[model samples]
Target: MTIPPCTESGSSVLDELKAALGSRVSTDGELLQNRAHDRSHHDWAPPLAVVEAASTADVSAALRICHEHHTPVVPRGSGTGLEGGANTTADSICLDVSAMNRVLTVAADDLYATVEAGVMKSALNAALPEHHLQFAAGPGVDATVGGMAATSASGTTAVHYGTMKENVLALTVVLADGSVITTGSTTKKTSAGYDLTHLFVGSEGTLGVITEATLTLHPIPASTKMGVWSCPSLQHAVELVVKALRSSLRLTRVELLDRVTVDALARYTGYTAPVTETLMVEFVGDRTEVESQYARFAGLAAQFEAAEHASTSDPAESSRLWQARHDALPAALALVPGSAPLPTDVCVPISRLPACILATQKDIAASGLVAPIVGHVGDGNFHVAILLPPGDERAREQAEELNARLVERALAAGGTCTGEHGVGLGKVSAMAMEHATALQTMRTIKASLDPRGILNPGKVLAAS
Candidate 1:
């Protein structure tokens, strides 16, 4: 994956790109090299060049130049991503889209928002209070809309509002040949040709480069309530989540945190866990409906051998509880100094989630790994972050073993290796094992759309 000074096209192509982009393009020194890889602990291999795109035009023009030069272009967002989707190799340029963060249009009437792909999710949520409308795609506040769409991200709201695959209405994409195409419609659902919008949603920037997006919005809930229920163990928490999902109550968000994770977070952050495990649930609606929903959920809680149930309607208090959940990654990372996480997202059927959790917990203990677990239990998607210190070869190997066992359990339960996080370089090997048939088809699509394989080469599908 190392480029030999781009001999295929030579210096003229590089000079052409540098001339057109000027200061926007750069060759790797040290800073550019740092931004090339994502949050993964994977080995760093910086791109040959980096481009800080300011607009859709910049992206399209860069793609055109790369297409002609037979060079690869790697699209990047905020680089907050845990997966290795943004990692770069040789003869490629990192298309950094962070500088293009602009909210182009906010149609309150249409209930849709159009923004440059660099727009952050937290900024969108912050700007929505005036209209009482909010964007639903929340995949850790640090993620960008473009990154979320590329990975088909989903989080606490997924059980109700659905994933980015459902939230994104359209995308302005620059194809491999620099031909631009718009997918999906502004008016919601459609019976369109090939559903290309979805095709690229979780394609992880292999099929095309996403420059801008139109996203769906929902009315902010009139009254929102969050609660914490403590359980005996991670298994008990998963059981409670399953029961809560099966109940008549419409839960907005349901998340599970294992004993190991709670203990780690307690040691890292100041917050203490009420028990060995806990479930954070949210109920949203009008004043009367929200209270009624809580009552109904409480009734179901009693049946699940509930150890403790705590509720808070105050926005400040709810935010405090959520702040801890939202900061789970950073807090867990705090426990391990000078180390990166080997985070694995595994989702299973509701009936199988408890089993998967139990198996994962046992596997984690058996593998001699330090894995703290947290997940969106509402839709049976969860993550186990394996902490590996720098130069700890044994820990890395043990973490890898646990990862394999976790995915095996999920797959045996008829689930995927990854639920929200896309198959970037970290999950690429597991994806091959889990999706042998679909993997070839995905490669076929990549080959067909990007004939020269100049768009994000060696990602999602390794070079054939």
Candidate 2:
């Protein structure tokens, strides 16, 4: 866990960085330890130093110095990533960009906003209410926009609004050599050459550092109705979701919570619903349109033997309802006090969702693990939070085995190893199984962009 010193002449790279960036560079032991890991289960050795970059110039200067010394650089935002995409290695420098937060422009007429990478999603939405627009990409966490773009994050809204890949219009990225380039433009569509914007979207900082981004925005819906329905079984709930997706219903969000998750929510979040498979759905449109869609969705739910139905148009009630859904993880953790959570997600084609989820539930039952299943099922993505008792190696092994089996099942069903969570340190092993030859092409692109192999080394692809 010792950081190898990179020296220049008589002085070390750390000395040079300190001289160049002044107080912006810090070797504080506590800060280095704090910045070494993210919310992921994996932890790495403490970084050599942390560079708090307040502006694009600072990012360029830091990258320039790190590139020169061949020191690995890990770009970080708010450090809320569930994967270790922002985690730093022992010999690396953690480039903290959360200080660059700024909303540069709100083109309400054009339905887009230009923002610095460090701006949080909550802050952006707070500024957009008066404009009657909002950034539709919701990762359910107040994550930095740059981190969201790096992970191609998606959440409950992605079923209708699409993920970050579709919402990000342009990017200002600092290359490994400190050169900055802007990819894409404000134009909605372009038949331009290779789409470099998206190429870097999910690169996870292994290619370059994202300093700023232009994000596509959507008008606030005139009417939004939130509803929850308890179904007889998981199969019934998933069937209802599939039916709703195919029907004329304009669902803005569709989420599923299995019986176990519903029980946890009921106990922890005061969720008043039957302990059965449930669906939390949202409809957005004109009042009349939303009403019609709600009626249609209710009929579909009834066909699947859904019960204890609840609907709300009041903003406060709606927020409370979705808040319960977002608090699923914490509620699940309460199921096993003092247990750590190992969360994993996978996305499959909609048609195969029912079987996939049912199979996972069966696996959880057989594994004797207290894992709760919840998901954005409209697009066929679901998550399992496996709770492990503290320092229980047996439970950890069982959780890992369960995750491996679940991933293999998803891959066999034409799904990905990860849905919104990027292949940070957790899912790197699955990349070969999922992408095969395409992974090699990714390595080629990584080499082309970062020849020194210093950009967020040992992530996305294993360090060669």
**Top model number, TM-score:** 2
Model 1, runs deviating above 4 Å = 1-10
Q: What RMSD does each model have against the real structure?
A: 2.2, 1.7
> Lowest summed lDDT over 10 consecutive residues: which window, candidate 2?
2-11
Q: Positional deviation of 363 in candidate 2, in angstroms?
A: 1.5
- Per-residue lDDT over 1-464 for candidate 1, one digit per residue giving the tens place of the 0 to 100 score: 34346554646667888888888987757756766788776665667778889988888888899888888788999876677888877657788988888988899999999888899998887888899999976675578888888888888889889999889999999898888899888987888678889899998898998888899999998899888888766666777767766666788888887777667677777676564778888989999999998887777777766655567999998988887787777777777787788988888887788778878877878876667888888888989999898899999988888888888888888999898877888777778878888878888888899999887776677666
Which lDDT values do the candidates have, in the order given?
0.82, 0.89
TM-score of each: 0.95, 0.97
How would you encode candidate 2's per-residue C-alpha lDDT over 1-464 as one tens digit per residue? 55545434214768878888999999888888888888888878887889999888888988888888889899999988777888888778899999889999999999999999999999999999999998989599889999999999999999889999999999999999999999999999999898999999998999999999999999998988999888888788888888887885778999998888889988997788889888899999889999899988888888989974688998889998888788899999999999999989999998899999989989999999999999999989999999998899999999999999999999999999999988888888888899997988988999999999989888889865
Candidate 2 — what's its lDDT? 0.89
- Give the clashing pairs for model 1: none
How much is the lDDT of residue 428 in candidate 2?
87
